[model samples]
Target: MKYLLVREDEDGVEQLWGRCAGVDGLFVDPVPLPREVLTLRGCGPDGILGDVLAGPDVSLRSLGDLCVEVWDDEQPVQWWTLVDAVVVAHQPHAADPALYDIVLGAGVRKDESFVELSAPSRFELSGGTTAAAARPSRCSAVDGLFESRDDPAPVPMELIGCEAVEPLLVGTQQPRRWARDWAELLVLDRHGGVMASRVVGLAIDGARPSVLGDGLEDITLTDGGDGRPSPAVRPVWEKWCQGPPSEPNVWAAYDAQGRAEWLELSTRAWRVPAPRPDRSGGEYHVDGRFVTDVPGLHCAIAEALLGPGRYFGREWNAFEDCLAGGFGVIPPFTLIWHDSEVARRALEDGAKDAGERLPYFEGVVRLLERRGVTVLLR
Candidate 1:
């Protein structure tokens, strides 16, 4: 958990850079920047080098016990370490020893792959800037920088520790994070056959569906416009509306917690007919319903059974393939919704020009159910 902060001083010389402490309460001194260190200048102005460093085309090397935090003034820009990384290849430039590129697996995921970094130039921290320098080539303070100290500063080490937080904490962009969320949803479906299944978009949120766990509240259901549900939902909704008023229904199993969640409803305003009874047949009303939230266990079934894809429109059955082993069995995924019910209806009814994929929406749900998903409908 020790961090080595790296930054440029006012004169652009490397000073004791980090807020990290030694045995006593003083700031840790700058060590010889690791030869493995990747620099901003190496990334080039267009960020071509940075992209090369992050791209999947490279290999990984070992990340030793140390972690590095880079700062632009007081604000941190990047944090990384050589610890736990895989070293695939190292290419040193024949023209300059300091100008080289090394490829290493960058993140903490088991399947995490490689990113390459080019040290285009020797780091600017080369010469001794002080009067005590004996050898003019190297910094005279280099020895003092590495020496462990026991002298206490004005503040306690504990106080410093509390104030200076580690900057290298992993983020959502990490493959590990994406895999974790995707796996959580698949596991819920595997254990409890899709606790909640509803198409979300259009009247609800007017966007494609994505897999949202704790983010369900972010997609608030809308209660405006002609309340008619999207065509993708109209057929089933029409069938359900034919019976008694569709009571606030809930289907929950695995992650079922009794909390209120919002849902968009598009139906005939039977309880309160339009006052004028307009002959234009625009009586549909879109409203929101509060149901006991359970999709967290079942992955929060607000709407949008499938999320849209990268190249095309909404991919309703993409989740099926994802569960069936798309996205590396656990790739990054998000909730998506269809633009309109008509679009989904066409996909479902196999309309020639409008749809091409066979509609197996119910069958897919059943498949997950058979695998152990407990479907609770209320």
Candidate 2:
């Protein structure tokens, strides 16, 4: 069958809405969420911007990991506005992650790119090193900020909100609250009579009872027969359509959109794992076999900690949230990433988040350590 669409009844139970041939956006990558760019007019940082002086030629610099603290009147606490490293107008060294624009004068939005700068600290960098020092292609590099010219003795720099920092995605993808004629079918679990659910995009049109979800012809509806997923993953889905395997790690063979569908189905099916066995701490092993891409990494991790087919997180934020207790295990636990050389060889390249890129495997390990998880990479 192309898909078996199911919906909840009046009693909050999902029932079969008949099978469907296909719909749109089912296997598509999620759209990036709109960026939340806050325009801070009067800005000031406590000793963060070491010695950046006001100048005509805008300085090009990089700040590694910055915790931009904003005061919240309602909450009366400092809010974290953290962004990755950057360069003003150019891509900085991978070591120097971000570049925040800092104008000398205090003003308002000149246009979409430039923001009003009052008084603020300017810092951008990556890998805890200045871009110029490592690369030396631009001006002489220092740790935090940099300038190309040797002007004069620095004055008391008047700072403003220079719109140099790249806005990160509010969420991984903007919430598509509504679905089109076709939606993804998620099988939550095998227990409880195979609990199932789907996005609310599917609806019956006119009186065509046979034509479900934009009408699936024999061609598109035929999984593995025709190559909707090309050939590499066709065999994988062909097996999946039969019924999700009771065993785990079915995600070993998928990537791109196909990888996404695997996560959706595996997330629901893998919830059968037992709760955190030890409240104090425990050992979780991440099998590195399928840990090639980002989604594959999540699949391996989820299966490692939660159990086969379980979902710890599809992305960094979700994984971070799961570390705050609940889910399955608590932090301060041991996470032995076995055969990690697989990830080392495979994930040497950077992984893109929002619009920025950072080291994939290292980022994951750093995150675990930051959350109090002991990572023993083998």
lDDT of each: 0.24, 0.44
lDDT for model 1 comes to: 0.24
Across residues 1-378, which tens digit of lDDT does each residue of candidate 1 receive?
Answer: 122323334597643222221112122222222232231222121111222233455554232322333334333333333333344554544455443444443322111113322321121120111111111111111111222234222221111121121121121113133211100000011222212222111112221112332221111123211122233433332332243222323322111211211112211121222223212111111111321221221122322221110111112233333344322222122222222232234334221110212233333234345444333222
Q: In lDDT terms, which candidate is top?
A: 2
For model 2, residues 1-378, the per-residue Cα lDDT tens digits are: 344445555697755544433434233222222222222222222123322322233344434334332222222122222243332432223443343223221111111222332332332211222111111111212222211223222111111111111110111122222222433354223232233344433322112213333332211211111112234444554555555565767677667546755665555554544455535388888889778777788778888886655667676666767778767676888999988988877876434221122356876787788789899998
**Candidate with the greatest TM-score versus the true structure:** 2
Model 1 quality (TM-score): 0.15
- Residue 77 lDDT, candidate 2, scale 0-100: 27
